[model samples]
Target chain A: MIYFKKVLKKIISPYRIAGSLFSSQYALMLEYRAEIVLWAISGVLPLIMLGLWTGAEARVLAGITKEDITRYFISAFIVRQFTAVWVMVSFEEDHIEGKLSPFILQPIYPFWRYFFSHVAEQFTRIPFVLVIMIFLFIGFPQTFFIPSNKELIAAIIAIFSAFCVRFILHWTFAMVNFWTERASAIERVLMIPYLFLSGLVAPIETFPESVRAFALLTPYPYLLSFPAKILSGANVNLLQGFLCLFLWGSLFMFISFYAWRNGLKQYSSMGA
Target chain B: MAIITVKDLRKNFRVSVKRPGLSGSLKNFFNRKTILVEAVKGVTFKVSQGEMVGFIGPNGAGKTTTLKMLCGLVHPSGGELLVAGHKPQSRNTSFLKDITLVMGQKQQLIWDLPPLDSFYVNAAVYGLNKQEASKRIDELAAMLELNDELVRPVRKLSLGQRMKAELLAALLHRPSILFLDEPTLGLDVNAQSKVREFLSKYNKRYGATILLTSHYMADITSLCSRVLLIHQGSLFHDGSLDELTLKLSPYRAVRIELKEPQPKGLFVNYGQLEEFNGCLVRLLIPRETLTDSITSILNNFPVKDLEVCDPPVEELIGNLFKNPNY
Candidate 1:
C-alpha cells in the first residue's frame, strides 16, 4: 500500500515532469506545423462520409435524418481523435535499439513514463484539433447541429471510457514485444481491424447488419463509435454502452497485467 | 559484514546462430541451431563497505554479465546475490535507492535537453525534493567543472562533458555503492584524468564502495585498490594489482639508449629485448637479475642513458590470464 501511495504521489504530481514533457512536445509540434496542417487536411474522410450519409437521408433511405448523420460522424471523429496511439511504434523502436534497458535500471516503472508521455502528447494536440473543429463549424454551418449541454456531458463520459479501453489494449500489445523479437507484424495485423471496426473512418451504422453485430461484440467499437454515438446525440442505450465499454476495459487491463508479469520472467535486458 | 555478496552466481544465455547464404537461411527458419553460452559460471565475490575493487576481463569474459546480475537488470539463472542487504533480483525500491550503475557506453541524459534537465529528471525518479536535489547538483557540477556545460544541450557537449553529466546523474541519489563499467572508454588524456580524479575524490569523501570494470588498465590502476580479473566466465585471479603483477610477471625492465644502433640481436645474453627504437632498447630481466643486467649492459654497449621500471599492469594481467600458473 505504501508503494502504491508513493507511485500515486509521483504520478499525480506531474508538474515536476509533465510540464517539461508538454513543453518539449509543443516545441516539436511547432517545428512541424506544416506537417500537422497537412495531416488535418487529409483527415477529411469523415466529412466525405457525412456528405454520402446526408444524401442518403435526404432521399429517405431507411429514414436517416440530418441530425443523426451529424451526431454520428462528429462523434466518430472525436472518438477517433482520442483512441489512436503511437505507443506500438515507440515500444518496437526502443526494444530493437536497446533503449529499454535504461528504463529497466531506473527506480520508476517504465509503464508510467510512457503513460505520462502519451497524455502529454494528447494535451499538446488538443489546441490544434480545436482550431480544425472551429474551421469545420464555420465552413459547414448547415450540416451538423451543435452539441447540447446534455450531449456534451455524455460526450465527456464516452471519451473518458474510450480512452480507458484503448489504453489497456495498446498496453497489452506493447507487452507482446517481450515474447516476439519484432512486434511490427502484430502492429500491421491489428491496424486494419482497428481502423475499420473502431469507426475511425466510418461509423459502425454504415456497416452491414452482420458486421455491425460482430463489431458490437468486439472491443473496438467501444473505443471510438460508442462515444461518437453519444456525442452526436444518436439516442444510444446509455447503460448498455457504458457496461460494454467497462467490460472490455477491464478485460484488457487484466490481459495487460498478466502479460507484463509473465513476460518479465522471460526478459533478458539484452546487451546491458 | 559484507555490504555486497554473491554465492554461486550463474547466468546462461541462449543465442540462436543464424546460418548464412540463401538456402541455409531458409533452412534456419524451420529449424535453427541454438547454443547455450554460460556467460557467468558460478562466480562468487564479496565487498565490504567502502572498498573500491576493479573488475577486469577480456571481451567475452562475462564481466558485464556479472555486473548486470548485481544491478538486478538481469536475473541470474542460479545464485544468491545480495547488494546493500537486499536481493538485487527483487529490485526493491530500497535496494534501488542504495545502488547505482554507470555504463560508460550507455548514457541516461536526454540528448535534446540540457544536462541540468536530465539531472532534474533523475532527481524526480530518485524521489529527491527540488531543494535537496539542487544542492547536490550544484556540488556535482562544481566538482566535475560542469557549471557552464550543464546549461548546453547534451548533444552539443563534447563526449567528456556528456560523460561527466552521466556521472552526476548517476550520483544524484548519493547511492552507497556504485557499479562503473568502462567509465573512461572514449576520452582524451586530460578528460580521463579529470574523471579519475573526481571518482577518487568522490569515493574518498563519501566512502562509497565501487566495483569498476574497464578494458583500460589505467582506470583500474588509478581508481581500484584491489582487482578481480576474469576470463571465459570464471575468475582467473582476485587480489591486489601489485600481487597479480608480482605473481604473474616477476621481471623488471631496463631501458638503455645506445650511442648508436646495436646489432640486430646482440643483447640476448642480458635479457629479452621487449622494445627497440632508433637508439633506445628496453629489456625484460628477471627480478633477481635486475641489478646485474643493468651493470652488464652499461659496461658492454655505449649506453648513454638507462632506467629500470616495473612491467605494466596490462602485461602482468595479460600474462596471468594467458598462463594460469604464471
Candidate 2:
C-alpha cells in the first residue's frame, strides 16, 4: 500500500500541471471560438466521401450495407474530429518566432504544453461536433442509432489512443523545423498518404486485398479505421488493434524524443 | 562564489547564401553554398551572486547570442561554461529551476488569456501550490505596481503593462539567476524607468544575480555598476561603467555662461571649443587636465556660471561600434 501510494503521488504530481494548462488553454480556445467552428466544419471529409460513395451507388461493396456505410462514415467523421493533429504547424511557428524559449527554460518538457492545448481544443470542438452530428442525423435519420455502452467506451479509448499516436507522429516531424524553415511542406506530403490510406475516404475493407494489406502495415488505418469500425459495429480484432496502437505509440514516442534532443542542440532561438 | 562562470565561450551559426534572380536561384538551389558565421567568439566573463551586470553591444555583436548560450537556449559550439554548478547545455531540471530568462521581444504568457491565468499556469508548472502561487503573485504584483491589469487579456494591456505582467510571470519562481535579453527594448522612458526601479529593488531585496542586455544605456547606467562591452563577436571590455566611460571617452562637456562674450582664441589652448555664442561657452576638456583648465577659465575669464559633465556614454559607445578605431 505504501509503494502504491508513492506511485500514485508521482502520477498525481503532473496532474496539477495538466489541470492548469488545460484550463488556460480551454479559455484560450474559447476566445477563438469562431476559428474553431471553421476548423470543425472543415473536417467533414468523411461525410463528403460518404456522399460520394452513396451517390455513385457503390455503398454495398463487399457486404457493407447502406446503413453500414452511413454509420461507418459518421463514426469516421467523429474520429477524425477528435483525432485531428496540427502540432506541426503550431510548433513550426513557435520555433521560428522564438516563442519556444520560455517553455524550454521551464523544468517540464515543452511538448506537454502542445499536448494539453490540443486536448483543450478538442474539448472546445465537442459542441460543434455535436451540432454537425445533429445536421448529419437530420439528413439521414437512419444513421442516428446510438452506440452500445461497450462500443462507446471502447471507441473513446481507441480514438484517444489514435489521437496520441497521430500527435506523436506529427511532433516527430515537427522537430525538422530546427533544421529547415519549411517543415510544413512535409505535412502536405503526409496528407497524401493520410487521406487515402487512413480510411478517411473509404472503408479499408473496400480496398483491394493487396492494398488493404499494405495500408494495415502502415499506422494510418489504425489511426482512423479501427476505432470507426468499433463504432460502426463491424468485426475487428481488438487485441491486434490495441497492440498496434501501443507499438506505434512507443516507436513514435522514442523517435520524437530522440529528435527533440537532437533538435535542442541546433536551436538558436531565432528572431529572439 | 561565482554563480555563473565562462571560459572561452564560443558559438557559430551556418547560414545559407541565396541568390536573387531565377537563374541564380536555380544555380543556388542545385548547389547551395553556406558560410559559418561566428556569433560569439571566445568571450569570457564571470558573474557572482547578487550582482546585476549589464551586457552592451551593437545590433549584431553577439550580446543576445551570449545570453542564449548562458540560458541554454542555444548550445555553444565551443567553450567551458558553468551556471550554478551545472552545465547550462545539459539543462538539468535542477539547473532549470535555478534560473529564468526573459526576452523583451517575445512573451511567454498566452496572448488571449489574462496574465493572472498564465501566472497560475507557470506556477503550477513550477510546483507551487495554489496558496503559495497566490501569495507570490500578490507580492510580485505589488512590486510591479500592477493592480487590475493582471485581469486583462495580455493583448489588451499596454506594452508596459504586458511587460510588467511578463516580469511577474518570469520571477514567480524567484530563480537565483536571471538572463534578460533586451528587457527594456521598445518601452517608453517611464516604463523603462519603472522596470529598472523594480529590477534594482528585486536585486537588492532577493540578492538575485542578473545578466541583462539592452540597447537603452539608461538601463545600464542607472542599474548596473559593472558593464560588459562586446564588439564584433568579442568581449571588448568588462569593468565598472565609470571605468568604461573613462577608457572610451576621456573628455567632459563643460558649459559656461560668461559675464561677457569672449574670443574663441581665449579658449583655443584650453581645449576643444565646442561652442562660444554670446556669453555662453561650451568646451570638451580632457579628463586629466579638466581641473587645471576649469581653474584657468574661472580665474582668467569673467565666468558667470560653469557646469561640467561627462560626455554621453551612448554616443561614445555608438561611435566605437561604428568605427573600431574609436
Candidate achieving the largest lDDT: 2
> In lDDT terms, how accurate is model 2?
0.92
Pairs with steric clashes in candidate 1: A71-A232, A75-A228
lDDT for each residue of candidate 2 in B1-326, tens digit (9 for 90 to 100): 88899999999999999889998899898999899999999999999999999999888999999999999889999999999999999999889988999999899999988899999999888888899999999999999999999998899999999899999999999998989998988899999999999999999999999999998889998989899999988999999988988988888999999898877788878789898897988999998899999999999999889999988889888889889473
Among all windows of ten consecutive residues in candidate 2 chain A, which has the lowest summed lDDT? A54-63
Candidate 1 C-alpha lDDT tens digits along B1-326: 79989888898988888878998899898988899999998888889899999999888899988888888878889989999988887788888888888988888787767888777777777777789999999998888988889888789999999999999999999988999888898988899999999999899889999999998888888888888887789876788888878777778878888899888478877778788886888888998887887777788889898888878878766765677553
> What TM-score goes with each of the models?
0.87, 0.95
Off by over 4 Å in 2: A1-10, A55-61, B21-24, B260-263, B276-281
Q: For model 2 chain B, give the 10-residue run with minimal summed lDDT.
A: B317-326
Query: What TM-score does model 2 achieve against the real structure?
Result: 0.95
Which candidate's TM-score is highest?
2
Per-residue CA lDDT of model 1 for A1-272, tens digit only, reads 99999998777655665554455545445555676656555556676777777767432554666777776776676666665566767877777666776777777777766665565555555776778788878888765477789988988888878876777778789889887867767777887888788776666766778998998888888777778887887778888889998888888888888887777666777655
